[model samples]
Target: MSSSAPNAVLSVSGIGKTYAQPVLSNIDLTLLRGEVLALTGENGAGKSTLSKIIGGLVTPTTGQMLFNGRAYTPGSRTQAEELGIRMVMQELNLLPTLSVAENLFLDNLPSHGGWISRKQLRSAAIEAMAQVGLDAIDPDTLVGELGIGHQQMVEIARNLIGDCHVLILDEPTAMLTAREVEMLFDQISRLQARGVAIIYISHRLEELARVAQRIAVLRDGNLVCVEPMANYNSEQLVNLMVGRELGEHMDMGVRTIGAPALTVKGLSRADKVLDVSFEVRAGEIFGISGLIGAGRTELLRLIYGADIADSGTVALGSPAKVADIRSPVDAVRHGIALITEDRKGEGLLLTQSISANIALGNMPAISSAGLVNGRDESALAQRQIDAMRIRSSSPDQLVCELSGGNQQKVVIGRWLERDCAVLLFDEPTRGIDVGAKFDIYALLGELTRQGKALVVVSSDLRELMLICDRIGVLSAGRLIETFERDSWTQDELLAAAFAGYQKRDALLHEAAPRNTL
Candidate 1:
């Protein structure tokens, strides 16, 4: 499809981008009105670059874009939006300090005589929030206080506010719950009905088949395939994305299970995390499965001392001696490491070079007498880059310039330098690609082989099943149940995840007074 096509809402020809080197090249694609186009590829394959070009976040080195048959050149995101072209990027574009209502209507505030109309803003925000299943949340609540999943929904809602001719969603459901994802799909259907052109970008192949009418696959900066989505299966799509057939079964290698290396007893933190307790053995990967508000991330934060536990004890080693962990520094000193879910916000210093980011925590080895050893710092980063297969020009490349999956690799690479006995990974592969996910899985297996206990929290139950020795389900801030790999089923895990919430709801119902007329 080209710009000349009658129904084409947007089209790009000879689209290419280069930064230090060519990241995208010679891409020709068209978006039809009221049709969903699925754009997918491995990380660094130029999916984001192409979307950014179309969305006006980045300028293409060589190319031309046509919007409804007219030449379109967007110099800034504001310019693009003004022309009814909007995008919800993978990296959130939100003001943390602002209230949800304020962020949603920041560009076009409802005002009268230079005064903001609080009533109008709240009403509009509530209507938008309800579309994404955020009706229960107060519009005046600060965005920073909401979980990553909620924040992602807020970003989506903001884009859907005004007249939107073209909407590009880049990994929109990465942090969303299954229910939240359903809500998003429902909204997508409504948008389709309204004749909105959508470019849905995601690594989740199943999602592409579900939502997109046509599929466009990119590989190594080149457009490889553009066909009806039904023509290819998930496995076939994966093969196209990575340029190789990936086996269904993973090779975790041989490893021996050992004694309990990390133990949490009676962990509680107000209503968010309630009396959560578990033990992770050396040479074992303990997986945490839960819904978005089920307190999975909060539990991990408590264990890592990112947040203090109101009442709990964290212990390390065979005999289970309690460790006093009040902060991240204390946790690190005690040989505990946490790979946070919000990689951009919490994990990496985006402006810094890859070498500098990797050398952040491992300064002791890379520095001498307060003077940093440049050779040692570079070597430390180079070792992990090679190990993690991080795609970059060199160690000096800034983390912000790298792709999302590659940036995640740098975050993992930083922790690999430390010989932490217990590692906690919170949505480690949240926005990563399939091939890179396997790489991290292999790394986890290696850690287990080294007798390091690993705790992985993931929204994907299949992911937990694939890499975990035992899976523990968190429900309404409680550890509902823990099942061995062979003993657990998907349905069983999901039931356990909702068990706490169900019980709580039942109790609340019984406590409420009933009026009889």
Candidate 2:
């Protein structure tokens, strides 16, 4: 007796999971040969858990799966790899100590006797890297030397190596440039032609619509919808994922922009940032957009005093004057708060309780005569949490257990609890779902309403366009142009984003001279 579904490469039935709480329940999905199925939902919605289970990284508490029309349960990631299942996790899996060649062929290094074949390694590495459009990177380069985007490419290349029946890519384009993303889509097409089953998970909804043939939406551990990607518009898909009606577009709300609240003049740091000057007004949402490595983050770090500037002035206030921001402590003393891109590293104390993490930043305010006021601290946490709408069981819950979006909210909430007059956000909505992103945008709106100045740096061009009153495009560490909300178009902004990367001086020098705050 043979199964009727001959083309089904993977079939999951009654799949469920639990970890200190019920995460997933009664989920079913199918991956046919040569088709791209997208799984999307808010963070902690069990999408990652499902993909992890399929990749043998986590054990499902309840479920049965059939692979190639047979009962399949992999004991480990290695076992899954042996069975031709691969997962490219959002957090990169490459070893920094190893060379790109070594990381690519870590499990099965080519060797004769006991001696590794460097020649053969480079040859094989180049081919695989080229497959993923990484032809420029030398095979012998250390993985640590590469930037985040290039590292992501290496991870993808590693997964595409040998015997890949099923490939699961989690937020694959999160760090990639627009050009690299197109390259990835091309590779996906090539793989599909060879009958590979691909599962793509991304927070960027538009990418899913473009690349996936079918979409499976999961929300709060339950499968909400599964259908051809063609059937659902962006709004419908977002509605299914977050269980709410949301417009796919954002309009500039009426907000009064006032005197300069934060100002940087001639900001320069080695070659990472150069002669950058800008002013962000009170109640103004100023956005900075650029390609990766274009000095946006470096510039923010300089203003926040996370990094030192060679020669520049940073100021904060309604009537701004140069403030000596020699360190983050100095910056904080002048009412400046920076929500870093690396949330897990610089933003949150993950192992601590949510209340404690939020309370950590404002100890002086929460303390009475140096003795901790437990009640005031808890109240403070609850206040910001409510305002931010951070989803958590209670303030007592550990920050580590919450989703990416919630963790981000906690970081922002901590800063919000302070008396900061200026907030600088770097990739503020990175790893956040569409619904949560809107929530953040709304939160930003509220902050501006309170007359707190904001400087946001983002890789997402449209996100900046949606939220910012003014948008500045940085090129090769230079503030090439800054455009007012009424003065910019999407195509113009996109052209400016790639200005530094366009391989010509004409593009590098283009744009309106600059905009006054």
Candidate 3:
């Protein structure tokens, strides 16, 4: 295959995909060298399906895919890799037991006549790691030992090891820190300089505006629009993706906040969580912000009884009661709900239907006299889907088939349906794109307005700054400081979160009893 023109690395015309039903129809897309094309859509909006078709992970049920003006049909991932097309999926695909260098050089190890060249493999892995700005990670380090951000870098290095012409990244920054995200953008720019056609898929519209040359939107299994990034603002992009104006109506209206709904005093969890104390008032958005591994997630798990806290007191004001909740079921019965950080692992039954996942939270409410009430369950699921504006083919569709944003919504809907008063959300908007993020934020506001106290734990400083009224900063498993919305800046919050631990210790000492000292 050869190209007459200098541009147009890959082209797709009338690309249609179908499984049990139509997943995409008449989708047209073009990837040009030195340019980034962002694919945006809501959950189950056919973005992943389209990407799969391009990467040869899945063949389109209809339409044609062309590379450099030649008919291109990929029978397997190997074929695509050979053709200079590589895709990094949302879910990582690294062998955890393997060393980082081994994983990077798995496909193309330097060899000497049936013998592997260890030195060559290590050198090549180092070069690839450097390309992605991950120089600190030793090639000999185990893949499982690295954080999610480092794992992502390894995936990128794997793609770069190939003669990649078209690079596709799906939700790559979902688990990254601010510094890591900047590094990724720098590497992406370098790739663009090398004339590699990049297809970037993310829920964050702001990122697309910064890095992407153009943006394409998909809805209901159809290509809705494709235009320059400059042509669309955040609001316009969201409207196009969702096919409706997302308004402030999702706000949980203003309500009178009562006494503290939940109070955690002297919470500790081994090395991950130190003595942490905080209070979430009814109808308030109490947010927890810190860098990754700052103990925010462990603290949430302790509150929800997912992980045991060495010692802590949780007091609920509703009926003015306090009790020891040592398990998830106990927390649920006590009007508490937890939306975990790892949605795929903890929040969803990927193989089950949306209805099943939604109904799983409160089974007794949907059941009747030792018999499951199918009609009532269906009705309840339908109501949540409508309320949350979850985009799905049907309530019966498997959750695994939906996009990242939609999956998050399903998890949230599960808790919302149970009418939980104290909701703890961990990275609630982690993998969700920008437009969907706004919807979730609005939904959080609505929850607070309804007198439901929310404690949101997030790595996104901007997200915490925008949605939370009061933010708590944690470091080394300890609560270092607290900031009101007006008093906190991004830099200040970051500093307090990472460097204020000593100050917190001093404060704790001053507050302790003289007899104990």
CA RMSD per model (angstroms): 1.2, 5.1, 5.5
Q: Model 3, range 202-320, lDDT digits (tens) per residue?
A: 87767888999999888888887888989988788878877877753333455677778888888998978888988889988898977666788778888888888888778787544
lDDT tens readout by residue for model 2, 232-316: 8888887878888888677546688889998888999997898999999989999998877788878988998888999988877
Candidate 3 regions off by >4 Å? 1-4, 95-150, 232-240, 243-252, 310-315, 318-327, 433-435, 497-517
Question: Per-prediction count of colliding residue pairs?
Answer: 0, 0, 8
What CA RMSD would candidate 1 show?
A: 1.2
Q: Which one wins on lDDT?
A: 1
Report the Cα lDDT for residue 283, model 1. 94
lDDT (Cα) of model 1: 0.92
lDDT of 3: 0.83
Off by over 4 Å in 2: 1-4, 97-99, 115-123, 138-145, 249-253, 369-371, 503-517
**True lDDT of residue 420, candidate 2:** 88
lDDT of 1 by residue, 1-517 (tens): 6578888999999999988899998999999999999998898888888988888889999989999889999999999999999999989989999999999999999999999999999999999899888988899999999999999999999999989999999999999878889999999999999999999999887888999999999998999999998898888889977888887688888989899999999999989999988999999999999999999999989988999999989999989999999999999999999998898789999999999999997989889899999999999999999998998999999999999889989998898868899999998888788888898899989989999999999988888999999999999999999999899999999899889999999998898887643
Root-mean-square deviation of candidate 2: 5.1
- With a 3 Å backbone cut-off (N, CA, C), the pairs that clash in candidate 1 are none
